[model samples]
Target chain A: MLTAHKIKVFQSLDKKKFRQKYNLFLVEGNKTIKEIPNSHFKIREIFSLDPSEIPTGDFDTTKITPKDLKKISFLQHPKDSVAVCELGEEKFLANLPIQIVLDGIQDPGNLGTIIRLADWFGIPQIICSEDTVDLYNPKVIQASMGSFLRVNVVYRDLVEYLTHSDAAKIGTDMDGENLYHHKFPEKFNLILGNEGNGMRPETERLLTEKITIPRFGKSTESLNVSMATGIILGQIFSHKG
Target chain B: MLTAHKIKVFQSLDKKKFRQKYNLFLVEGNKTIKEIPNSHFKIREIFSLDPSEIPTGDFDTTKITPKDLKKISFLQHPKDSVAVCELGEEKFLANLPIQIVLDGIQDPGNLGTIIRLADWFGIPQIICSEDTVDLYNPKVIQASMGSFLRVNVVYRDLVEYLTHSDAAKIGTDMDGENLYHHKFPEKFNLILGNEGNGMRPETERLLTEKITIPRFGKSTESLNVSMATGIILGQIFSHKG
Candidate 1:
């Protein structure tokens, strides 16, 4: 059973400041818990409604009732399980392959999807502008589907990262070098934009190249920002040795 | 000002049956409304707090109090305006370079993102199984941007569309051929799957060839279904044409 203090602490982790202070985040649901065993993330505390909630594990566990589960749950109905995991320490890129940098992705789900895609194509890491969504938002943790464990994601000022880094920075745009026609750079930092309006012009100015996925028909002006990440990552994976 | 009876009818659009009965759907916010102009969708009614709600056009408009907007609004806080759009008639693949079939995609957001990506790629039609989400869900409408206008999406049984259609149905899966080496067919029906699980087994059985985007590094077993669509569609668009 959870106390009011526990619920308050769980809810506070939803905020970026609290997440940063604690160096922890939470992921809920059966799918997310299952992915944790194979992920790079470390488990902190797990509270479950069912004995079978988490697959057999050595992590510290607390069996609790559904009412207890509700206190920590962000969803309308509390999930069967909840796990607090240690956020992976931020890492600097070395012998880097293709990397992804997010300028101002505000939507937590989109940010989570970006992390999941980065995990899939094996992009070395993701660097986010300070304005990016909080990694610990339960929505992001759920959306990431455990890719958060595998991908090295960090939030830092973009101007500082790009100004000092030698990696070729590619920005996606509707009108630019056709991604298909453009040569995949050996070392590149791909930048995606905000969920609504894309990269601020100042950020766009820092980009060394602007590439676009060529549109074949009369359809959407731009793909979802996360979709852009998948397209770019998949293509880069295809070209890598 | 809008009438209480009229507001009650509009609010009912939150349900599938209600949307079907009215043959109308809701479009929220100014950006979504702006995307609709020059789109294939038709505006049935426009509701906003201000007469200047929409960008201004030849449509019949109704100015409603913010209270009325809140009564029928899907958003947490009502936007300045929401438009009721005429749902397009069921469309078929008349002339298509490529088409997509969503086997059992139940999430409105995924379905919307797929439609938006298909729209950007100029893929004309999407045939969904009957159980798929209502394209009119405010969530779907919001996520699709205005691509729902350009994309012709229809709902039919899974087996029916694949059985009658001559397009080579290629389904994505784990055991399939690596997409990197898979030859692109001229006429293909690219199939995406549900979020939690991969394709339905029977759907996988009907696939001409199961295909996968190869993983370049140590990573999760698969890609998100929506991410897979972008990778495959990007390949199709980038294919030598």
Candidate 2:
């Protein structure tokens, strides 16, 4: 029988406060869970209906029924398993290369995709607004495809972060400089905004420059936030080489 | 009263054979429906739970109960409206500055996202394998966000299409040239494979040159197929500028 303490602790990890209190984040789905054993992250426990496929490790685990698993899963239909890993605090940014600031991207899929973008370009850190979705959101973890393990995402007020960074602060906007014409800075923070709203007006003031991708047609005024990140990152990294 | 003939047509559009036979496809949600008004294609019908917002037009419309809409909607929960469209056969590549080829992309969402990416970068046409998810699949239409309106997508045997192109034949692969170091051709047909299993061995043989994204970490073997397309396109467009 599962004790109330374990169940309650399992439930609390979903919130940022609980994740902070315990220094843990949940990774869900059998495939995502399996990848954990291979990761550098320290696993706290495995909560699942079956443990046969999971590797035998030093990590603590509690066998729970499928119904018990469902109660905590973010998916409408829960996967066979989920694992908890210690959340690493963001390390000091080494001046090595390109940096990204997620202004207020709210979708977990978009955030994860952005993190995956960062991992591909070898970007070291992504600073996020407190309003941005939690990096620990299971959906973000799933979409990231283990990239979350590598990329450092720190949450703080983006405006404050932008204000402090000596790196060029570039904001993506429809009315900004055409990306084709603009020269990229070697050291800079690329700020991409929310899907619905590009960037807050205050965030706009913080930008050292604003860049735009020319519209191919007006049918859709802009690309999806995540796609824009991929496009921008590609441009920035290609310039580096 | 809804006639059996109309129901037959609607039901048939769901299957590829019927869609091919009649050259019909599906679109969903209000934004897409509205976007179609400005598109070059013709509409077959509007099926909606709410008749109040639908425009008066020559197209046939059936009032569907919300319960009935769920039966036809590809989404777990149905959108407010869905429509059938006559897939237009227009060859926009009278001349090709740039082209995209999709090799057996099975997922409709990824295909749609790629299509949207092409539209954003102003790439002219997309060539897909006959096995690719239909351009008119509701999931593709919804995800494309009206890109199908401006962009032309063609279906052919990918091996034949690559062999026949006067432009450069580019394929992305794991063992190929690093995208950053490789010299990019001015006019080329960029081919992308499916999500998990990449280009067929036969398909890989025809590639003029294969290219790979240099991943930063050991564990991340690949990017999501859609993400790969975005990264590649971003590089392509940035170079053209």
Per-model DockQ: 0.61, 0.43
Residue-level lDDT of model 1, residues A1-241, one tens digit each, is: 4667777888788777888788778888777788888877788778898756577666777898887887787878778888888877677665475778899999888998888887777676888898888777878877887777777788888988888779898898878898888887778788899977999788898999989877776764567788887887776666652
After TM-score superposition, the amount by which residue B212's alpha carbon in candidate 1 deviates from its true location, in angstroms, is 1.1
Tell the DockQ for candidate 1: 0.61
> Clashing pairs in model 1?
A217-B122
Candidate with maximal DockQ = 1
Tens digit of per-residue lDDT, candidate 2, span B54-140: 765779777888877776676777778887788787564644867888888999889889888888777757888888888877778
Residue A107 miss distance in model 1 (angstroms): 1.6
In model 2, which regions exceed 4 Å deviation?
A1-24, A29-40, A47-56, A61-81, A87-97, A217-219, B1-23, B48-55, B60-72, B76-80, B89-95, B217-219
lDDT of 2 by residue, A1-241 (tens): 4567766776887677888887878788767677666656778778778888676689766778888887666677888887878876566565645778887889999999888888777876788888899998777987898888777888888777777778898888778897867888777888888899877877889989889876654447578898888777766666555
lDDT of 1 by residue, B1-241 (tens): 4777878888888898988898988998776787787777888778877767577677877887787889989889888888888877775765364778897788888888888888888777888877788888888887787788788889887886677778788888777788878887788788888787766777777888778788765665467677788888887676752
Model 1 docking grade: medium
The true-versus-predicted C-alpha distance at residue B130 of model 2, in Å, is 2.2
